[model samples]
Target: MKTRWIWVLLMTASAAQAEEPLGCVEVTVGGYKAPNYDCLSQQMGNNPEGAAAAQKNMEAMNVPVHKRPPNQLGLATPAATSTRMGNTFGTSVKPQRPPN
Candidate 1:
């Protein structure tokens, strides 16, 4: 039973190692190694078609400004009761009258 389990583990490990990433050319910059996105995109076939598909998907998911529903709770309106311009400051400075 121990030998069978060991054999199965080795086989699974080998199988996992056999499957490598299609793209992913590692880029080294300042001792930091990361996958080159451009190369990966090209290798994985995400150049133009993928971008277009993504854009279309985003557009489909988005709700246009004009099509959105009105604010039911009136949160969009100003909280202050006074409509005067100077009243916006909460009595910090009174609105001055023009001198004749």
Candidate 2:
């Protein structure tokens, strides 16, 4: 009975494994495993359409990084000195301290 149970469990496990979806198929050409099914198929020339599709997908996933200018910051300039103290706030109204 124990042996039969073990066999049944093994069969169920195998079935489950077979039913599970696979992400990619790996192939080694020059001692390096191909990253994904598309890549492997591309290298092997098994499916040109599949390879092109995979390449397109990868390119879509990649985003170009915009480079900043050499001098990122803008140059600073000195402000004009106020001829009159009351004109400092850009208003003709006499400058007065707010109620404390």
Model 1 misplaced regions, further than 4 Å: 1-21, 27-30, 43-58, 61-66, 71-100
Candidate 2 segments exceeding 4 Å error = 25-31, 36-100
- lDDT by residue (1-100, candidate 2, tens digit) is 9999999999999999877344456679999876676645545665559778999999876645444333333422223223333344455446534459
TM-score of 1: 0.28
TM-score of every model? 0.28, 0.24
lDDT of 1 by residue, 29-49 (tens): 999998777766667674668
lDDT of each: 0.68, 0.60
Local lDDT at 3 for model 2: 100
Worst 10 residues of 1 by lDDT: 72-81
